[model samples]
Target: MEATEIIIKCILIVVIFAISLVVAMYSTYAERKIAAFFQDRVGPNRAGPFGMLQPLADGAKMFLKEEIIPANASGLLFIVGPSLAILTACIASAVIPWGQQLTIGSTVIDLQVTDINVGILYIFGVVSLGVYGIMIGGWASNNKYSLLGAIRAASQNISYEISMGLSIIALLLVTGTLSLREIAEQQHGFHWNVFYQPLGFLIFLVCAFAETNRTPFDLPECETELVGGYHTEYSSMKLGFYLFAEYINMFISSAVMATLYFGGYNFPFMDDLGLSQNWITIIGVVVLFAKIFAFIFFFMWIRWTIPRFRYDQLMNMGWKVLIPLAIANIVISGVVNNFLNNA
Candidate 1:
């Protein structure tokens, strides 16, 4: 790559990282506001105009507070646990296409960091590794509650990941490419994959909730029974890392959903705008984020709306319900594609 291109890519990388952190931070504020709104309370209005500065205040508190490593805890692994969680969460956005390429003089800037051909598999692999962070943290804490939470998280992610991958299989059969950018490009101008793979989308959405350990499936960190779940023994920024990672995962999942089911940067009536390439790219980016925010709101809404599932119910839904539906979707997609290709 030319020096200018390298510089540009580096800048983009920093920007992407900052955006992820900012979105994750704000998601916490949004979640609190949403929760308060649901419960008919004023929420954090005193901090800074409807608690706009609450995240920064919370973050500062986390950094300033004392960090504790229990005498019984494995210090190295304990530190590694939260670090790994945040690391995995941050890196998963690399393959996501943020927007169309921008033309600046002779230099063309693609909004994505890297477009690996096996982007989808890369996502699945990285996401699978995220469970290790929770497992390691909980195990290293040397607390029974932590260990139990860790085990629950590991099992939950593994069970749902199967269905999540199977659901994606149907979409892959339809799209014929594992590259996320290619999939997004194919769905340009209102031809979103949701129309073709609605079942796959639903299965994927449910699996996503499980994967992220959101409410209704948040058995791993169930506050009532586990007292704080995997990070119960953690404190200060070490604990902050784990919590921040969850929000980051939510943000990334939102982006992935927007890319997969809705359309990454594609929008209806985009062509009708008749705008310049730069303007079009900006608008597409806005449209994509709008969808992402809507999904994020839905996630928070579900967290407040649904009661946490009983463990048996959570397992049954994963194994007996979602997995089978995902399998059926794959079979149907295959048969339909076969008939279409044959005819």
Candidate 2:
């Protein structure tokens, strides 16, 4: 790459990292606030104005807390688990098309950090590896509860990944590309895939919740049964890493959902307004985040509203229901596309 291009890529990576950190931090506050609202109670209002500084306080507290490594724990693996989880979560955002490219003077700046052709596949690959973090951490702790939590995470992610992949197949049939940027470009403005592939969207959405280990699909961390799930033995920043990674994964999943199904960064009447390319790109980025936050809120709302599923029920729903539905959506999409082309 040219020096300028390399510099730009570095800058983009830094920007995305910063954005991901900030979003993950605030999502904690957002989750609490949403949870409180759903329960008809006030959320954190003590940290700052409307609890704006709550995440900062939370971070400080976690940092100041004493670290603990269990007597029987594999200390190295225990440390590695949360690090892997956070790293995997951060990297998944690399392939997402955050916004359209912008031209500044003579140089072109892509809003995404990277636009690999196999972007969707890359996302799937990285997301699949996230389970290892949980598994390693849980196993290393040498606690039966942690081991069970890790097992649950492994099975849960593996089960849902199949459906998630199948759901993407349907989208691929319609878009004829696996590159997320191309998909986003094809879905300019209101011509979103959600209009055409509603079933695929639903399947993907459910799998996303499962992949992120959110509520209803959060059997891995069932407090009642697993004693804080996989990270039960972790304390201080180690525990914080696991928790922060969850929110970061949530943020990334929200971004991916917006990009894949809701037309990332695209808005109705966007082209009609005769806006500059930079401004248009900026608008799309903002709109994408708006959509992401909406999904995030929906996630929190569901967490508060729904009950956790039994382990068997979670597996049955993922493997039996979502997988079959995703396959059907793919077949239907292919048939319709073939007919449209021949006609």
List, residue by residue over 146-218, the lDDT tens digit for candidate 2: 9999999999999999999999999999999999999999988799989999999999999999999999999
TM-score of each: 0.99, 0.98
Candidate 1, superposed: residue stretches over 4 Å from native: none
Q: Cα lDDT for residue 44, model 2?
A: 97
lDDT of each: 0.94, 0.93
lDDT of 1: 0.94
The best candidate in terms of TM-score = 1
Q: How badly does each model clash, as a count of residue pairs?
A: 0, 0
The RMSD of every model to the true structure, in order and in angstroms, is 0.8, 0.9
Query: What range of 10 consecutive residues in model 1 has the weakest lDDT sum?
Result: 42-51
The reply for model 2, stretches above 4 Å from the true place, is: none
